[model samples]
Target: MSKRRKRKPKHFRGVYALLVFPFAEDFHLLLDLMRRFSAAVRYAYNRLLEGKGREELKRQDDLLCTFFRLNTRHADDAVLKAQAVLDSARERGEDPRKVVFGGRKLFETLRRRHLSGKPLKELKREWKEKRQGLLYSRGDRTKGGNLNLRLEAEDGALWLRVNLGNGRYAWALVKTSHPNLSALVERVHASLPYNVELSLKDGKVHATFTWEEEPTPLAATKENGVLGIDVNSDPYHLALAVVGPDGNLKRHLTLSLEEVDRAPNRGTKELLLWKIAHQVVSLAEEHGVAVATERLKHLPKGRRGDGSGRAFRRKQHRFAYASLLRKVHSLARKKGVQVVEVNPQDTSAIGMLKYAPLLSLSKDVAAAYVIGRRALGFKEKLPKGYGKLLRDERFRDHAQGFYASRVRELQAKRAQEQNPYLRRRLSREIGEAKRHLSLLSSLQGSPGSQREVTDGRNSPGVNPWRVLRVGTFLPLLGREVPRDLSPLKVFLHRGAWEGWRESRGPHPGGGPKRANVHFG
Candidate 1:
């Protein structure tokens, strides 16, 4: 097997809770330890950039212990944190020499504080707290959850035991609104490993507990059936389809995610996503079927000023596919449901051309149907109707003619349009029309059993589905994604070369031409 790609660790996103300490203990002592730990982290970071390894740094951690007044454990964790920061900077393609432990944003804020009418003293205080108010202790399985810091359950409430240097320890009552604190407690009781983090935010101390959770063995299997999920952006809903083992649609439904968009804050929105994830898993468990979803990629949001980049970000900001999918995957694992990720390529087009009209299902639901079938290890063959449409010379000509007219129209407008943005938009349309014309023009010979058409050297291995998608959708139906796909029913059953559609001469653009509403 090839080398596996490194991904984010499978640990849970940790829980942050308020730390309430006893009045008798000196909180400043905790503050002093935090200051030393922060200094060691920065020192180790600089040393790492000079080519020092972790083990080398740890062996001579006496320099950190003596200089920062920290113990061996704190010194070790400081090296770990510094290594993490360096690795992250390299991953993001940044120079490690310019790495700022306190954050560059805080430095910039000092310059902007006068404009915002905020006091310089307060800004400085905030910056200082950010730099020195961090503490971290990694867990050791041999040491029962943690070494320097530990969580002890006492009287139904969780309290943190913090180690101060030279045989001194401090305790703080850990209070959290998060419901998963019990899971942390369970790990602590079982002597399983768990990491601890403490940071001061606005004078209040907070503790974070994190661990990698092992998933339960999958109960639901694809042998029973598959439930495919499609998250649509425009309507802001999740479309689901239940496909039987034989690859036939059993039932389908949609769950609205509009409430997540309307949420007032990030935390609330995350909670809402988790709730939606629960519902999806519950459905899978109820049907005893594995879940299937698109294996989406992380495409970079390009820099602004480029027309395509701006357009990409505008649409991307309005949806939450990855975040929601991660939640779904995490919840499914815990619930003992299997989740199969399928390649999203052509699933949309295949659904639009084949199943939409045949099953009278919506486009999103049809795509879900394709996903379910694919997860069951089924290869999608071209439908007979669509295959026949590709072989029809008249149909291909009509499609090419429509795109030719569109290209001419866009080029005409692009010449006269004064606005650069509008001209750029017109250029994009012109390029799209020319591309469609190219694809349709490339179809030379008759498609065989596989219905594969050689799309020429420029575009190789063009299948019937692609040509059918380009040929039928905009040319026959008059819209890329028509609000009413019922019109495609005729193309599906009767024939793709519609006489009435082709009889109407191609308008300037894809839409119908009308003069004063085509009558007045």
Candidate 2:
């Protein structure tokens, strides 16, 4: 009999197991331990800022070890992690000297400010003032840093240990009796932890363990599934649109992340973030799709102009768009789900104008729809009622009259203004109004015997401008046109001008044919 072959599992996927302190008594010991370790990291960071290289830092590690009362290995890990952070900062156009150290709070602050679009100078100032941070590491096959902190599930009990570099280690028994934490403990028993982080939160010790497993691979194409999310500030924190493989809406969800917003401290904020991350991963995994988010990397810093009030600035500072994206992205990566960032321009406007009324969705939900459509490379939808307004002669006449009156008013204003700035502004407004009037007149098929083409595509010959104008503005009026069709191509396809001249009599050759403006 032939032996059956066993297929290897997929690449390891990362899952987090958060273990809270079982015994309240160990809290102070863990806090003091973290504080001293944080101090050691700060010391190495200062020396590195003073131009100390890895070799010099290694040689001087013992000096810091003595100063901070840390063991030799602990000191080495601190220097290594500090150097890594400094190198990363310098590479990202940030000054290494401005690096801060205040343990987990420092990391959280930087993350918050980065998402809030705080200026780099301001961030540096905050860090320079704080000058403290935590040094957390994952465990290796052998000995390593606190990030290398390890945990195991064996003999019906959870065993946690963190080597403090000498014969001494911080060991604890994590409680698995509670229903809330038992599942996480069982997971540890199933697989050895791949990474670990130890931190002091609210004066209580908490350890986060990461385990590796094979992820269910997601399809590469958008057809498989797509998740569109709109991050906003209000009653609903996230508006999500789930699209099926057939370009059909599967579900819509609005998540209220008020807790993340109302979080009173860094620890609470992180807890909220972790919860949100888990929710996102669960949704992505369930749908077997990629998540879509706005590309908000260049979001402007809060309340920059004179028009912005102090209250508005404070609100902007607390906006969580960037932080939310980061958390979703990090969790999604571990789950092997794809993340797509769509351009955020006009999403709200397009959503309000088109999808809001059609889908009977809220402004935020409509925007989420647009975001999803964009990620899927679908054409933007048009409002059903917009066509009648554009096609109505009364509406066209009213529009033209409005702009013409505006032009005259602006011209009068320009003449009356003695101030150069006011006059220039008036002149500019006058020119703009006139241009709009002219464009409208051309669109409405001009009143004069000799009609001047206002469509930007043509002139003395058969004007391709008519086709260009139709193609450009038709969509705004609920008309869908082929995107790849050029002005000349569209004109030829209709034989619009040829038919116009044929109707004018047997004159086969004449002046350039006036384009027929009536296109459905």
Candidate 3:
């Protein structure tokens, strides 16, 4: 046997930190610089979109450097930022022609916002409203440009020197009174960040840095175990469950989210989110395990046509799952914990159905338990009721067989019927029976994967078979499925496939094989 190749370990992890700046007289100059930078970036973006070739865009970048009177490096930065946005949109399947930004959207792009403590959902709304002006700027990543910031030792006092664009400098004293000042300054001095940002908030200057720290990547396997987190609303913000490699629950934790849930102010909500992030990181560190959470996606805007109240709609909008995940992942990385995301499908229902009774835990904790098991590559056993539903001979074999037999009978009747209208009716009935046979066969083989069974259905907690209840399951007692079974079925007077259809003829077979019928 050949030797196995060793996988390379990931090294650098990103960190965001804030440093305060003080200025009394040059505040107006700082604002002026922000406006000019924003204008230049917007112009470059529009020009980039209009250009058809990469070489042509490079030519335009050179012209912008002259027209904007910006340094060559700074002008190149603007072009790169524009290209990054266009590339991202294209990757997401968005049309490039419709991706133009204007109004408040353009100004919002001027800020280095990942460092902002605001929840991403709220920040997005504010970004799209009027002009919030520039609260921050991620200036050129080089050593000499606007974002070039360094802590200098002068006259035995710690001072921060920031290069404002247009070859200007602003100095601020590092106040010894601030609790985190020493730590912040020491980190910057050690890392010497490549990119820096300047922010003007509450009439005070602040500098933001995106630095890379030494990485402590986890091993390929963690025998100690995994941490599963379920993010939810109300009294408990998150439910965390730790499970061993053997798939047994080790511990359960609930983070109280009362303050964030009840907060009326956006700032307070943001602060509470920070505290939650810290808690998650601390827990992961204490356990020395990998972190896991549900990978939620394609969230609907609201309960469409469901008659949900205004308060309910507003509450749905305020819960930002993506932002909270970002915070937790970032903090966990800093502490050397590996983060894992598992598919969110059926996690809540499966937990409630299988593990809740055995562990005597709430549904949320049980769901977290399922998530942990998923991350560990362990299979969760189906509930006993689910197995019984699948094993029922009527559902597994007889229902589909009935439809198939009825389809054959109708085909024979269509051939014998003399009246034109009666022949057409027989043909239609045969087509309907064939279609139902296909659907039932699909379910018997793979119940949840069939388009007819899963389409337009979003009820997560209900049993999959129950969605086909009433007209579908009840039809077994009678000769035909009720009219209500197909709300959209039209009167099919024509034969199957209508006019000029290719025929492969019929199958020479016995009742479709025993292996296909029984799922156990």
Instruction: Compare the candidates by lDDT and give the number of the best one.
Output: 1
What do the candidate models score in CA lDDT, each in turn?
0.79, 0.58, 0.57
lDDT of 3 by residue, 1-520 (tens): 9999997544343224334446664556655554554556666667777774434444545665566555554555556656776888788898766764544354555465664445665555544331222323343334432354556656766666654656787666644444444554565555444344454444444554444446666642346688899976533468999888888999997887667768799878877887898887777778777889888765665753343445556667767667778788777776678888888876765565456645667768888998998888876544444444444544445456656766676687788888775676567566766666665555554534322222223433333433233112323223222212121111011112211022322112213322121100
- The segments of candidate 1 whose C-alpha lies over 4 angstroms from its true place after superposition are 1-14, 22-28, 35-39, 42-51, 85-116, 119-133, 299-315, 445-460, 494-520
TM-score of 1: 0.83
> Candidate 2 vs. truth: CA RMSD?
12.8
Error of 1 at 474 (Å): 2.6
Worst 10-residue lDDT window for candidate 2 reads 506-515
Error of 3 at 472 (Å): 16
Error of 1 at 254 (Å): 0.3
Per-prediction TM-score: 0.83, 0.53, 0.62
Model 2 regions lying over 4 Å from their true place:
1-36, 50-52, 59-72, 87-93, 103-137, 143-166, 175-194, 201-204, 211-215, 219-221, 234-237, 244-288, 297-337, 357-361, 379-520
Worst lDDT run of 10 residues, candidate 1, spans 511-520
Best by TM-score: 1
- lDDT, candidate 3, at 17: 38
Candidates ranked by lDDT, best first?
1, 2, 3
Q: Return whichever of 1 and 3 wins on lDDT.
A: 1
Total backbone clashes of candidate 3, pairs 3 or more residues apart or in separate chains:
0
Model 3, global lDDT: 0.57
Per-residue lDDT of candidate 1, residues 85-185 (tens digit): 99999998989898887889888877665544457766787888889998999989999889899888888988888899788988889889787877787
Consecutive 10-residue window with the lowest summed lDDT within model 3: 485-494
